[model samples]
Target: MSNESNLQVTFSKHCNGLFKKASELCTLCGAYIALIVFSPSEKIVISQVPPQNSGPMQFIEANRSAKLRELNAMLTQINDALDIGKKRENELSDLRKKNETQFWWACPIEGMDRVQLQLLKKALLDLKKRIGQHANMVVSQGTPTQTFPFFVGNGSSSNMPIEH
Candidate 1:
């Protein structure tokens, strides 16, 4: 009478064919199937094949063993993936530490010649001021279009969040 009822009837008709084929597969394979199906409208249907000529316990045990093997294989694959990711992370961390140590600016610039250090300091200060001005301009101009706050800062150190 209504659209919901029409949809239910159509869904029921569709499930009839699915259940028929599933039963046939179970019969041919000598395997029982326990199925839980859901419709788009959230209606659930559960179906289980009846006990075969062989006992139900044997069928259930075989299913359990098969599922256990599948689960173990999946777990092994996940463990392998995790180990690979950990090794890659360690390698990347080592590379980053090496890179940081190799940088000239990473050392104490104070011990260098006064003129060189002063030039470096002035260059760094100008870069910082320019970056701050750019960030403020973006924040002031972009806030009306977007709700999130986006701020950029100087890139004196890799440890800091902002990059040049």
Candidate 2:
């Protein structure tokens, strides 16, 4: 307002300050930014971007391409598909737990060698015998008694039969 004749000088000072701030931001925070200003006199007063950043024109062209839009759509679809898969996996896990509770023998057996299978079989048989003995005692006494779960000295809790 005070020095209208110094239009060029004013523009130069403002541009220098803006660029300095932009550079500081880029260096301190590792952020790349672009600042563009247009004056009323149809003059492009300032355009600043970090050295590593693309020009405004290049940024616009890359963002506006059809291939970029297509890739974004594909990535969104893949993320949605993965979410659905996770939900389905949770549902199947619940179903498996329910089925195992109903029929312990039909539980999914994976990554088990022959020795492990034999040990599990022995543990299940011991559990069955214990259940039968506890039931007989309950009938004779007409009251349930506390029975500890069958342990096979293995470090696994699920080594015991799936209790109904």
Candidate 3:
């Protein structure tokens, strides 16, 4: 054969081999391939691997939907956390209000009603009686009586004045 014909045959052989390798690679890796070859004789050869399913658009849409679902799940979790935080805040606020409204003996008596004042007087009298009892007990036990400057007569007075 002439040199030109031998070159054409060699070109055809190599081109066929390249196409086969490309086909093998595409099949093994599940890849898309588009190959175009122009022979010395001005002939065109085209090879393409068809994509699976609808195409890239379908894949992209599915991926987008998955991402949106994930984002919505995250948003729901955040909303639930915010609701829990609000509930906790409301509980703490209620506790604070209850503490602020509850009455204590040490609190200021300026805003007390007449009935409240009577209750306070009774409580103070009861406290004075208990203190006198305790003092008597201590004295009976042979413990020397300690004079407090605030007491008028050895802590035995029923009308012991209470100091604010």
Candidate 4:
């Protein structure tokens, strides 16, 4: 008897066959491999194999399981952050409604009992219209007017243009 072995493995043109070959090599040689690929649309493809001999399979399995746990932990963290953001958004919307109803700018003049809230609202609308007209007049006249940069709410601008 001779301790000799001859093994032949063939693969189709598909990537799954390649994966099987890699897995076979890992199982026979007691090695580990981490593979990553990508499609044209920038999606990720990944694979991993653990050592097969010297009790390393358990270690590899553990490591792979650990990685899965890590991914789960990260997903949980992301979910928590999203939940917090949603809660904050709801709170902000509620605050806006409250603020709109209790607008100090629309309050009546001090010590004027006869002034009503509706009247104050009409006055503010008139003032806003006048301001808008003045701004349009200035812009139409091509006056060198200074305008301040302002944001209506807390929104972030990203430099990278995401495709989807």
Predicted model with the maximum TM-score: 1
Alpha carbon lDDT of each predicted model: 0.68, 0.69, 0.69, 0.59
Ranking by lDDT: 2, 3, 1, 4
Candidate 2 lDDT: 0.69
- Give candidate 2's root-mean-square deviation (CA, Å): 15.8
Error in Å for residue 147 of model 3: 21
TM-score of 2: 0.33
lDDT of 4 by residue, 1-164 (tens): 13222111111234566678888888766678877755334566688977565466667777889999999999999999999999999999888667644443323356223434444556557556766876898889988655533212111232222111
Residue pairs in candidate 3 whose N, alpha carbon or C atoms collide under 3 angstroms: none
State residue 83's C-alpha deviation in candidate 1, in Å: 0.3
* Candidate with the larger TM-score of 3 and 4: 4
User: What TM-score, over all chains together, does every model reach?
Assistant: 0.36, 0.33, 0.33, 0.35
Error (Å) of candidate 4 at residue 107 is 13
Q: Predicted candidate 4: what Cα RMSD to the true structure?
A: 20.6
**Model 3, range 136-163, lDDT digits (tens) per residue?**
8788897766544232221223433434
Off by over 4 Å in 2: 1-107, 145-147, 155-164
Summarize candidate 1's per-residue lDDT along 1-164 as a digit string, tens digits: 36888988888898888888887777556667877889858978999975354565567668889999999999999999999999999999888667645543444665446654665577578667776877787898874332332222224443332245
